[model samples]
Target: MGWHIEGTYFENCNCDSICPCATSGLTAPADYERCQVELAFHVDTGEINGIQVGGLTVCLIGDAPQQMSDGGWKIGVLMDAAASPEQAEALGSVFGGQAGGPMAGLAPLIGEMVGMESHEINYSDDGRRHRIQVGDAVNVDVEDFVSPLDPTELGVRVSGIGFPADTLAAGTGTTATVDVFGMEWDNAGKNSFSAPFAWAA
Candidate 1:
């Protein structure tokens, strides 16, 4: 009944430079006067209800009205197709906020559960860049930004209130797309970042 997970996560949103959601738990108006984003997680090591979830990938695509802190989010979830039925269910529980963990903290913000499904999720990280594809529903490619002060260093470190307290600001090399579960958006050259995250409950 207990669980713990640690991994790397990245997201692309319509917000400019810095997303307000990271700092204010509320997103500022973007191109659509709303916040649309796609988040992907690669689990390096994890377990839930005795189920091993290492090496699995999960994605969330959603949109929020006005401000994220105001809630009213319409979201959908996608799990890796390679996951077994049990693993899928366990993932659903945790992501659905039923199992209680880091995700539980954001459950209240969700206004609608569009759906959940298993898909062919491909995730790759090569030190500098992160790429993800969920069947034909989503595609994202991003890379860490070179520090202005230190070109050799990738990304500028920052602290915020989210799954990962510490994060590296990143930039998208290509446009990201999401077309699934009635949520459609194209976030090209927008805000993005990545961080190592750990959660337990």
Candidate 2:
């Protein structure tokens, strides 16, 4: 059995300017030497082990100690409530790094799996702005940067070491709040961005 997923992805972390997690493979020291963050994904189309996963949403909320690559991330996962039992299990395996795929690359970075649950997930994108909500666990809003030279155009496109490598739109978090997995943080106006992504295994 194999799987492939492609869609939109974004994240909000309590970091300044560029987030080191993307470049250094480890998160830089944040307000308290830890990176509290929320990552969301909207699967426009996907499947795992023959299960359809299109149009579902998922989220990861947690914190990284010291550097992300140092491997001590305590996190929880939230899947769309609309997913059936089988779909939910498939999503859990994929995102939890148990199914071996693009997500397997991230398996080593997670030190603990605090929890996993199905929740009402809301996600939307209106060209320049993106919004995501995972039940009452997380909420985030981000707006793309407008080109300084040409306000009519979008901001710079970023390319780097992960999914959505070339289509990232640089942006700032208008609001980021999370309360789950024994972690609590608010990173309003922090580092955030959105992009289209594709992954397979």
Candidate 3:
């Protein structure tokens, strides 16, 4: 069986400007602790073996405990409500650390399934900027990068990886966190990145 899907991805980490690890080639915390990135993806144009899949949301949990290599990665997945059984299985497999693609390579480091959350997702694009909402779990809103000193704006770019997303993100009035495999994540940022990507077949 074969499948292909196209859509956009968004992510925000606890790292400071430039997320040093991405370019500086340095490990997280540059000392003892690790760096974590909570990535949320929305599939605007998606399909599985010819099935029309739209409005499906998924998230990825990434980290660089010992730099890029040395493995030790963990990932958590969330499936949309509209997904059928087959679609759910496909998504689970692809995101559950199977297939050995970009995410697959990081599966070995997964700690555990921190459980999945079913929340409403709202997205809109007004050409110049885009907006995303996590309903109840969390709220992710971003317009565009203009200036660096701007209080509610973050000016940065990551070329292809959707870097420098949401110059300023404010977490809603909630405590959203995921802890597993000795790793803990507190969703506090209100802005993230949205980009398109594809894994191996």
Candidate 4:
């Protein structure tokens, strides 16, 4: 049976504005010799194997080498604690790249999956502002840039990032941190992106 999900997603990374990985399709090297990122999403409406997973939040914590296309990333998953056992299992299959979807394309880039854990995930989306917090362990928030002439419109958007979405609105990370899986980062004032996404497998 196939699963389908549609939601809003955002991510923050320790990269300068206009990250090469995001813009160059992961063919370029990251700044500061490394890449640390947190990808967050809120499932507005979704189902995995008939299990409803709407209103749940998930985050992917990852660390990659300079050249992301070189293909070696240490990653971990944090799921909303509100999920039931069966829901968690189903959601994991979709995100773990076992169920066949956009995420499956990223499976080969993973060098190690640290683990998956349930946590009290707090995610909020208000237009250009997006935020995610998991207790005190993880925090990431981004604010999309807007045009000076018209503050309501996004300033930058690009296609082909390989994220489930066709185009992404670029932003700046106001706060980004992670303290899990023996990994820690204090990456603030970096690159960020937000977009509406739909995935099916």
Candidate 5:
């Protein structure tokens, strides 16, 4: 039987609407002048080949020219600092496109592999407060959506996600930028976003 891995991930890109890459579009340039994405993954129930796995997070920072599929892509993966060597290896395997799954399908389109780093991922949601951060280079905090009455709040929800609903996102800083061949972009945005597939580890 085919394997199913359930997880959540948040991506920040420099494109407007949905990133072209996700929809198999390679037109002009991506909507945003620059692009930066911080993806955090939590693998709940899954296995790669035969290795049992637990929670793991991967952060990807990349740059692509307007049209996705054009090619050039620089990517870096951040793993949970607490994982063991086996876990780390598994993380790399899954994130690196070696596991032969939905993500691996994109491997051929990716250009730069910035390697993988170990980190500690902490995500929490308290009533109306939500927090997610990766080591230090990336961080996201969301509060009740403004404009709503005192008792309730309404902001923006990513098209279909539930946890990070209608929240504003900010970044600490961008450590690097990449663009080459087909893919190209400079990712940098501190705006509110709501899109499908924001959380899929």
Candidate 6:
């Protein structure tokens, strides 16, 4: 079987303006002794093993020690509640790195599986601004750093970081409170990045 998905992705973490994980290619230690972050996604169009999976949303939350590449990460997955059992399961395989797609590239960095949860995901888009809300569990929003010379463009565009897209827009958390899997953190004013994403296998 084969699978493919394409959409948008944005992430925020407990780093400064620019996340070291992005700049150092996952090799630098987090700004703090530990790391806390969330990767939220919205699938505009996709399928898994022939199952339609468009309009679904998912978020990956993690707590890692030092460099992200050092592994030993405690992570959790959150899927939208609207999905059927089959859809949910299919998403789990893709996100859990079982379907052997781009996500597989990140499997080695996971040390502990915190499991998955289902909820009504709310994803909002406003130009370079983005927001993710799931009841009280997650409340986060971010906006890209606009180029000083070109207010309509991102201040920075990074590439070759092994992320969703070859180049990503860098930003910072405006407000956030991520709580799930018994781990929580506030990413307010922390590092954030966003980009349009497309993946296949």
Per residue, candidate 2 scores C-alpha lDDT tens digits across 4-26 of 88888888888864566665444
Total clashes, candidate 3?
5
Poorly placed runs, candidate 3 (over 4 Å): 24-32, 61-71, 125-131, 147-156, 160-192
Badly placed stretches (over 4 Å) of model 5 are 1-3, 16-28, 125-130, 142-201
Query: Among all windows of ten consecutive residues in candidate 5, which has the lowest summed lDDT?
Result: 169-178
TM-score of each: 0.92, 0.92, 0.65, 0.95, 0.64, 0.95
Q: For each candidate, how many residue pairs have backbone atoms clashing (under 3 Å)?
A: 0, 1, 5, 0, 27, 0
- State which candidate, 4 or 5, has the greater TM-score: 4
Ten-residue region with minimum lDDT total, candidate 2:
23-32
Instruction: Report the error of model 1 at residue 166, Å.
Output: 3.1
CA displacement after TM-score superposition, residue 156 of candidate 5 (Å): 6.1
- The per-model lDDT (C-alpha) reads 0.81, 0.81, 0.52, 0.88, 0.50, 0.88
lDDT of 5 at 87: 71
Please give the TM-score that candidate 5 achieves against the real structure: 0.64
Worst 10 residues of 3 by lDDT: 164-173
lDDT of 1 by residue, 6-52 (tens): 88888898877666667555544444578888888888999998999
Residue 10 of model 3, lDDT score? 54
Candidate 4 lDDT by residue in tens digits, 130-170? 99999887988889888688765756787877765878988
Q: Any idea what lDDT model 5 has?
A: 0.50
Q: Every model's Cα RMSD, please?
A: 1.8, 1.9, 5.6, 1.3, 6.3, 1.3
- Ranking 1 against 3 by lDDT, winner: 1
**Clash pairs, model 1 backbone:** none
| lDDT for position 94 in model 2 | 85
